[model samples]
Target: MSSPRPLNRRHFLRTTSAAAATGYFVGSSSLTRGQESPNERPVFATIGLRNQGWSITSKSTKFADFAAFADVDANVLGENLEKLEKQTGKKADGYSDYRKVLERDDIDAVMIATPDHWHTKISVEAMLAGKDVYCEKPLTLTIDEGKLIERVVKQTGRVFQVGTMQRTESDQRFLKAIALIRDGRIGEIVKVTCGINGATGSPVIPAIDVPEGLDWDKWLGPAAKVPYRALPQMREGYGGGVPLYTNCHYAWRNWYEYSGGQMNDWGAHHVDIATWALGASDSGPNKITPVSYSLPVEYENGYPTVDDQYNSPTKFEIHANMPGDIPLVITSEGDNGILFEGTKGRFFVNRGKLTGKPVEDLESNPLPEGAVEAVYGGPVSENHTANFVAAMASREQPISDVWSHNRMLEICHLANIAIRLGRELNWDPTKREIVGDEQANAFLSRECRKGYEIDM
Candidate 1:
């Protein structure tokens, strides 16, 4: 594939200037030269204002003001509102519904930190409403959602930054290690082992009444209905009653209804890096074969529900066939980390550290001069939020744009589908569909609750 033309700063300036004059609302805030100017700080609202939401909102220093906050739980929203006011000394209105927040013309953008189920709906709607979005990672809950989001983004011509912050941190050893391997420092790549945790056994907890100030039904969104449990306590603030078993808030990652478990949670980060390094951001695996899997044992009532409460495979080995007939096997073992093996040697990387054949070998390895720039073109903004803001101003794609992100997301989704189906599946990247297996294909897109269907 040929390299895309590098976006020029002069052209970006002219485009943004024209867009601003034509009354283009980048997100929630209007572009104005004032205490709240898009040039200085784009006015913004935050949806799902809890946990990672706080961090995403806090990091928007370059191009956003906390103009509005939305959450299904009023308690969480109230706390964040106070925190934002205290820190930024700017008052922001609070709302329980995100639609109300999106309706405001004064806001220029929105930072969505909701669960996997809510990501696509809010993002597509926000884009349609003419707001740039910084949605949290894993992009979407299902493969079909990713494709839908990509289409909406293209159709609306809006800037979208998936919250893959690992892409920002320079010292992110995993990404750096991948960069090293992609440079042929590891010789011809053969296989990759991505380690992630299996789902935890469901905790024993009773369903509790919904909290007074929370909109429990709305929080469930497009996901299937379930009894309310206490929301898991987020590191940032308290959550509504959703329970640790359901992993309703942060732990939602463990359950299938809301998330793709570790395959997507960690895969969204590590597997993404692997794909990025392979320069296969536009496509995904041609086939996914599950080498091994450990499904959660059936349970009764409170002990262990026989029903498949957690849809993800606890332990599984999935082989992803990339271009050139190279097979990348992403396995789950020994907690979480990524291992890249090539003809010459292999290296392992995780949040903690990077280790391999020789430490000095990796340290000395570097990408061919402009290779990194070629992959992530445009001005490299070290800060992820700043990059989104810059992209909004420049009308350029952010580092983690919808297209590349969906490709990575597809890998994880395919892996999950393979494990769930308990068999190997052939994939046609061109068609973006599974071949031959109608049963497997059914998993791609889920039946959205009435009125929540995504128009593709």
Candidate 2:
């Protein structure tokens, strides 16, 4: 199997046409043509320097020079800045506010991995500042935020890549899956099941003093003002040393205020690939039925009655009546991956494995050469950030463009609405609204806090 060659940053920075841009990839620390020339490197700054934020920046350092790092937590910003200095042998600036990083004229782009609530605000501002964007997925907290972002991308013509890396990485497993479906190896895709795994509900966390070096209000930008909350428990994996039960840090995923829980977290990944494979990225579901779900807290009128505990659903099985009448099942049960069942055969694919009869048949009845590339729209970039830079060079949206991402995310967002309201939702994809249910329709857009609203 052939892989993409490491791209020269210079070519990507200088190229203007798609054909010239398509040949290059990203993620090479050493310049092949001119090792000492600083002009060959694109300058970058990262916002939200937590786990995923640092992850993207780490990958990007190979192709872009780090100008600064920003985070609501001073500690995170300082730590990442120090790490970047050590890794690149160059000191970069650190800022508590992302706006400082945006103000720099030398920076070429910004990578946003902030919590779900803050994504749209930062992304919109970044594009308006003439910076291309590579934002983390489950990109919007609500459907309307996605629309706002789409508008900005169109108005600015800035390259935008959502952090749905499955389209590029995962060893091209997802790309191959899409190619298989197109190859008719799966015949007519009957259903695509995305098992994004459920999150554990949190116990009541009492209000506590905000940690020193962390700007609590800035961290909660665009989100409602709330008391800082945490339990004494400490998480111990990636992004560890943080409290395991809090509406901050790693635990923020469990709250409706900051995130969409497991649905948006993992659904952003697997469901995205499923939707791509199903060829439903341009359109959305006609209805969303919450087959079953369990929320950790009680709710009143779709709002959590209590705010101290994790309020996002703990488990769910949502069925979306998608375009072409395809049934897209996003559920918490089963293995953590996508299962594509079709008229002729079936297969299952996750980060680590792609199995079942169809995948097994590939050895004897292989897909055509360049199949993955066709699904990817071009040669895949070395990584997602590389894809973003390549897109910047070509002035084209990358494989994970916002338009397709929002179409699939509409299903996930509607599923949460269905679960919260304890009823099915009839959707009109063209109108982009909930049919007839005014109350559910209200969930499509959230009101941003007064001081943190996006500027156009």
**TM-score leader:** 2
Top of the candidates by lDDT: 2
Model 1 scores what on Cα lDDT?
0.73
Across 1-456, the per-residue lDDT of candidate 1 in tens digits comes to: 011212453454345445545433343234322233333557788999777898878777444678899998888899999999888888999998899988887777899999888999999999888788989988898888887887787776777889887776646455567567757767888877777676654544346777688786787788767776543442333543345455356656767778888888878988888887777887878888888977675522212343335545677778888987777777777757777888888887777777876446644754567454444442345568766776676556667778888898898898887777678889999999999989888888887777666533
Off by over 4 Å in 2: 1-39
Each model's lDDT: 0.73, 0.84
TM-score for each predicted model, relative to the true structure? 0.86, 0.92
